[model samples]
Target: MTSRAAQEEGVQFGLADTGNSIPVGLVTGIAAAALAAGAALVWWMRRRRTTRG
Candidate 1:
């Protein structure tokens, strides 16, 4: 009985850890995508202005 409880607790902890990892991964991915998009927008604006001028 105690063994089963311990096993259950371990599984719960593992699942929690996995769940935490997913959010961190998602946040990092989002930040990277935002940075890339911002850089692209800046580049496009600069190119357009230079071409016009």
Candidate 2:
């Protein structure tokens, strides 16, 4: 049963007509790249330390 206020306001709780898929995809891609870069930097630093020691 829907509330009277909801019925009057006509609020839609569903998918957007024009989705924000592109921005979401870009944000996820950038995050993955940042994580990968961080991992690579750590590996490089560890390798350098071992070689120096």
Candidate 3:
């Protein structure tokens, strides 16, 4: 019974790891785009605030 439990646990762990495998390139691209967009938005907001004030 213990052996069967261990086998089931291992299979579940393996699948969990593989199921979450995201490509590094895609992750990096997403991060870069988000950063650029955030920076641009902040810059625009500050510019507008300064102009109005």
Candidate 4:
């Protein structure tokens, strides 16, 4: 009975790990893209303002 319980727990952990990996990867990807875009926008605005002034 203990072995059966251990097997069940292992399966649950494996499933959780598999399910979480993709969304974690996707969130990181989105965050990186957003940061890059924000930096680019700031740089462009600064350049434009400098030229105008």
* Tens-place lDDT digits, model 4, residues 1-53: 47679788774333434455467878889999999999999999999999999
TM-score of each: 0.58, 0.58, 0.65, 0.57
State, as a TM-score between 0 and 1, how close model 2 is to the true structure.
0.58
For the record, the alpha-carbon RMSD of candidate 1 to the native fold, in angstroms, is 6.6
Question: Candidate 1: misplaced stretches above 4 Å?
Answer: 1-22
lDDT of 3 by residue, 1-53 (tens): 47679788774433444535788899899999999999999999999999999
Q: State the weakest 10-residue window (summed lDDT) of model 2.
A: 13-22
32 in model 4: Cα distance from truth in Å? 0.5
Better of 1 and 3 by TM-score: 3
lDDT of 1: 0.82
- lDDT by residue for model 2 (1-53), tens: 47667778997666778865569878889999999999999999999999999
Indicate the residue-level lDDT of 50 in model 3.
Answer: 100
Alpha-carbon shift of residue 38 in model 1 (angstroms): 0.2
- Candidate 3: worst-modelled 10 consecutive residues by lDDT: 11-20
What do the candidate models score in CA lDDT, each in turn?
0.82, 0.87, 0.83, 0.82
Model 1: per-residue Cα lDDT over 1-53, one tens digit each = 47679788774433433455467878899999999999999999999999999
Maximum-TM-score candidate: 3
